[model samples]
Target chain A: MDVTLLSTGIANVASVSAALARLGVRAAPSVDPETCRTADAVVLPGVGSFAAGMAALNRHGLGTALKARIEEGRPTLAICLGLQLLSESSDESAGTPGLGVLPVQTVRLDGAPRLPHFGWNRIESAATEGLVQGGSAYFAHTYCLRPSGRLEEAGWRVATSVEGAPFVAAVERGAVVAAQFHPELSSTYGRDLITRWLERARAQSAVDTTQGATPCR
Target chain B: MSMTRIIPCLDVRDGRVVKGIKFQGLRDAGDPVERAAAYESQGADELCLLDVSATPEGRGSALETVAKVRAVLGIPLTVGGGVRTLQDAERLLCAGADKVAVNTAALARPGLLTEIRDQLGAQCTIVAIDAARTAADPSRFEVVVRGGRDRTGKDAIEWAKEAVEAGAGEILATSWDRDGTGEGYDLALLEALSQAAPVPIIASGGAKTPEHMAAALRAGASAVLAASIFHDAETTVAAVKSDLVRLGFDMRLVSAPMLPSVSENSPLPS
Candidate 1:
């Protein structure tokens, strides 16, 4: 299946591309809107600041394409900062607007022992199927998506957690999916999560074809 | 965090894995890619590649080695040595290194740390401090650079704090006095650094047995890094991880399913 790995110019895009290749899936790292909008699946992987990531997407004119994919219920996965960009706004890079796919705001993990919550943490998956439940995933970020009051209304679910503080680990609202941790770096559990997401994307594409809908290129 | 990490540090000189006693008497260990794959299969949580001879010529060879290793390895890879400028760090990152470690350069110009952090993000920046106990003042330690060849007269603990404030996400503190001595890690140094720095501290130097690793973890290190023991096959990553787990220290055990053999060629469940 064709997978478009969106380049925000802030993350380790090579690692994600390598991981996809190892999974026997074809992926292209691109900033072009057409490559992202027409792919069977799209992944927005990021590592740097929210402002820098958003600026790149805007510069490449990928913001509108990403919105179109989400609105059409196409399969997409965002990792780490990519996950943060899906929110409506972030306290980090103050005044930077996110993609607004998920109705939530990302904030710093204040009062924690450390600033950037580096290292692996167990993710208690809320979804029963197609998600690695109760497995640890690598996380390296200071800002996180806190439990939003509009979570239920927006059809958002907390896919995992570290302590009692719930962050949006993985959200499955229609075809949009995101993980706050680096699945590319999370060893086996990470590989499995990516594989499951790809399988779902492939299945979704097949269903679209059967419905006689012309897939966007 | 899930568990304490067991990182196998590969000292590469001229693109080959090498081992030495406290940065002296260098000996070839093995090929970088072969040894890296072996470590991954043996359950190493992560791998670190230090180009002991990071000359302009050696830098090209190191990047080639990094690409080869990255091709087969599924875990995180951190590359260090002679990373002087932002471009150097960018080159290594582009070559497939998950993180770039800066030492002498960071010590020479502290602002380089901020520049790398701002450009590459602090998560990708690691500050490796080679520190030796002070001769005149036994209670303190001094930061050494140039592969532990020169002493900077700077306090190790104080430098660690400064590096963190300057945007280093992690500190690889190598105890020069204990490195390759096989006595054990400098627990007192690790304890002090851990308390002083807010970021994760990776304790390096002087690892002989799994118990030594356990002691280092208990001493407040977020992770334990070893070279000689793992390179020489004196111990395996699994043994050390088992020891740490047995001691009740949280560790990510390399399960059978986590092995690299479970690649794309492997069958997937429907």
Candidate 2:
């Protein structure tokens, strides 16, 4: 499968691209929207602040391209800062406009233990979805994605949550999948998700080429 | 009412599976996916995979490992090491991990907990606090991160409450002063942490015996996790569960087919 790793000039883009390659995916770092559209899947891995990441995407004109690709039913994976950019906006750096792919907003974890939550965590699943095999994965972030509706129905929504409010950690709409955590950095289970995504992208590629239909719509 | 949990943690390095002594010399632990499955078979309540590496390049291997681990274990798996933003947590979850654990980052941005909790949901996020008692404050432990490389100087008890209020649904408090020592459970820290927060607490560090497990439970730990005991075959999952049951903790016994551990380089099972 042809997979384009969106190079927003974020940290560790090569890592993710390399992982996808192991899954038989033709991974390439693409800043051009046209190049992104040509691939079966797009992976956006970010490492900087939300505002800066968005600015980068905007500068490369990939923001509109990303939305268009998602609307077209192409699968996309957004990791770390990439995932935050999927939301409406965040207070982290201020004035950062998210892609608004999911109906959610970002905010600081008030009273949080510290600046960045760096360690392994457990994910308590509230429902059955492909994203959740069962337990938790690692996490690191001061801000999270808050979504209002059922994650599945919203097309764009948070995958998991803390307490009662759901954070848009991972979003899946048919073929479109994105997350707030760095799966490539997660360990074995995290790598599995990337492998599965490549498979999904391949499957979706077949459908996209044959039916010429937008699965997301 | 409280909830039941199972966790599986993997040793990581350069983004792959690695193990080592207490925050020091490290070694490989084979493929992460294989190790995770072994833990699941043993009925791990939850899983924590920590990247022992400090370099950014090595951190990349950690993300690759999570993507692999998430594919095999159908249970909750948390990923850590060098995470600094909400996007990190989201990416891990997207790759199939259920939650993200923050340490150094959370200490740097205390309000970040609330921000992440507010965005995700407090239940899905967790704060992994590594604490060590200081000579100046022998009675109090302080939160440390970077694999116990950096000290936050924040009081452990105070930080636990701050984490919960910030949206952390759970806390994995590891005692650095006692980690890998296996002398005994850090009951004083557990007791204090439990009192400070309403969320579930997983008592880590210095778990030496089944008796230590009981002591932790009595001290208000929601769960007890140990590496030496678990990895050395010193105790089996059934034995530990039995011990918990005998200690008055309710446990469900289930018998499922145990599958052979699959290699990381192998194709996924059907």
Candidate 3:
């Protein structure tokens, strides 16, 4: 599969790319808008400030391409800050706008003893089968989109976790999956999650090829 | 809130696993990559690789070691030792370390922590403080550096606050008085540091048992990091995690069915 991982210029990208390599996939990291827009599978992995991440994407013109890909229902997996970038806006940087693909506000996580909820935490999802299956995952973030039933009302499968407050862990709609947790860092559960997402991405790409090319499955 | 993190700290000297003075001569025990994979399999939430052999001039082997371990380690890995400059921290992060710890160097010149934050956010800057009980004041803990060989007059609590002001995200608090004494963690020290530092405090040294770890957590530690208990074959990360669970501490259980074992030749996650 032609997987283009949108690199937001963070340093710890090795683990994410290595995990992809283990699954018999070489996810080439790229900031080129065309490559990001046209890839069979696009992974948006990010860390650091939301403003910086969105700035980098906008600077490279990949943000618009990314929103276009998601608008077209392409297979794209967004992780951590990447997930936040798909929201409408964020409290971390109020002036900086998100892709608004998910129609949610990325607010500061409240009710937590610590600001940045680091370490491993349990994620509970009711979906029988999807990108997340209610497993323990690694999380490191100070801001998150609070669960207000708005995402579910919009017909998206949402996973929720508590770190002093209930928040949206992941949301999947069609082939567009975004995770607030770092599935790439969750060890076996993490590996299994990526494998499952890739399988879905691969199947989606094959279907696209079939539809685009006359019943050639 | 979040679950208590169980971290197994690997002491590396010149890129080899150094299990303190008493070497645990297991088969290929000196290899950092092997031990890291084993710990992840055993359910460690995170791994801290401290290069004990790193001098003022950082060794390139440390970076190589971090890169190799990160290739197999799925969880977060924090690297320390010989990180005297902001460049060293950047190089280590590029080599795949999720967080960089500064001890002696940060103590000498406090600006390095701020520089790391300015370049690469405070989320990656960790200040490791080695504190010992002073005869001058048992209630107070003094900062020790150079692997606890040199004692600086700075107070541990005061330094932690200062480091946090200079952009430190977390404090790796090690009790020099109880490092290897097997008594337990200095709950008083944990309490003091937790009071002083607003950020997450990772308790290190003197973790004799799971009960000791629980005590440290109850005393306000966000995570518990141990070395001899894990490296000496007395206990495994899995055992400690289970014990913590049984003792009523909320912890994320680990079971890696897809991760390949160190001895396995398989490249794919089954």
Candidate 4:
């Protein structure tokens, strides 16, 4: 299946793209809004400041395109700062507007213990099946998303409430999946996750084909 | 709660694992990848590779070696020594390195931390602080830069806070005062930095026993990094973790599923 990964001017996108490649999935980097509309699935892979990431998406006019795709039931995945940018706003920079995909806000945990939490941490799975396996995944971030409601009930959000606030580590909404960790760098198990998602997408397409229904991909 | 970590430091010189005394008179311990795989098999929580050479050519070699290590190891790997930019970190990550540790570059340009972390994500960036206890004040240690070649007047505590604030995800603090001495960690420095900073700290330098590991953890270090003891064959990573587990520390047992091991048929470096 064709997987178009959103590249918002962030470096080292090949890591994620390569993981998808290993899964028998073709991963392409998309910096254009038009590309998001045609892909079977879209993955927003980014690392950096929320403000800068948003700026790149806005500059490329892919920000609006992403929301439209999500609304259309197309599977979308966000990673690291990409997940944080899905919120309404972020404390990383004042007045920075997120994609508003999830009803949440991003706050910097600079005072909690450090800025970027760099290491492997456990994520107790909220749902037995989804993008996140019921185990510890690697995470590296200072700011995290705090979703308002049961949106995170579909996935195990790693480490809720660092010091005082509920931080969202992973999120899943039907076909949409997002994570705060870099699964590409997460080793063999991590690579397996991408494969599972692709298989799920493929299986869903087969069912749609049999039923003469439109595939979500 | 986070699981306590046991990291084996692999000091590399000329593309092979080497051990030295006081940063001089080096001895070939084993191939870095072989040594790393052994430690991983023995329950090393993670692995750290520090390039000892101070040349541009050596830096390139370190990156290549990192790629080789990442290709074989399934667990996380942190690479240091001459990491100077976001591009360097990017290359290492693409090569399969889980994290990149920076020392002198961070001190020279504090903003590099944010740049690398922002570009590659913070969890993949580790700020390695080389420090030494100050004679004037035993309570404080000074941050040393350039592979412990120059001393920065920056206090260890202050630098730790700054590194964390600047977007460093973790700190691999090496105390020159206690390095290679097996005297135990500079607890005062560890406590001060741990209390002042908000992220996990990896205690390096002066660790000679399993007891030192427990003491550092009690002092708030989430992980303990020891080079000499492991490299010199005085102790094994498994032995240390077992000791820590026996001491009631929350150390991971490192099942074979969690760690990486080299195949028996693979070429073993002499």
Q: Which candidate is the best by lDDT?
A: 3
Clashing residue pairs in all predictions, respectively, total 1, 112, 0, 6
Instruction: Give the per-residue lDDT of model 1 (tens digit) for A1-217.
Output: 8788886663477677777878988777788897777678999988878888888899999988888887777889888888888888999888888999888888887755665677767787756764545687777788888766586687665676753366666666656678888888777778888888888888888988898875653
Provide the lowest-lDDT 10-residue window in model 3 chain A: A208-217
Better of 2 and 3 by TM-score: 3
Q: List the residue pairs that clash in candidate 1.
A: A38-A217
Kindly report the docking quality category of candidate 2. Answer: incorrect
- Candidate 4 chain A, run of 10 with poorest lDDT: A154-163
Cα miss at A145, model 4 (Å)?
A: 2.4
TM-score of chain A of each: 0.92, 0.86, 0.94, 0.85
Flag regions of model 4 displaced more than 4 Å.
A9-27, A109-115, A150-166, A187-189, A205-217, B34-45, B73-76, B84-98, B109-111, B114-125, B135-139, B145-154, B161-169, B228-239, B252-254, B258-270
What TM-score is obtained by chain A of candidate 3? 0.94
Candidate with better TM-score, 2 vs 4: 4
Off by over 4 Å in 2: A7-27, A46-48, A79-83, A107-142, A145-162, A166-171, A179-200, A207-217, B1-37, B40-183, B191-203, B209-225, B236-270
Task: State the lDDT of candidate 3 residue by residue for A32-85, as single tens digits.
Answer: 998888788898877777888889899999988999988777888898888999
Two-chain complex of model 2, DockQ on C-alpha atoms against the true structure: 0.04
What order do candidates take by lDDT, descending? 3, 1, 4, 2
User: How well is each residue in B151-174 modelled by candidate 4, as lDDT tens digits?
Assistant: 788887888889888988788888
DockQ of each: 0.52, 0.04, 0.52, 0.33
Over 4 Å off, model 3:
A213-217, B21-29, B55-58, B255-270
Model 1 misplaced regions, further than 4 Å: A215-217, B257-270
Models 1 onward score TM values of 0.93, 0.57, 0.92, 0.82
Candidate 3 is scored at a TM of 0.92
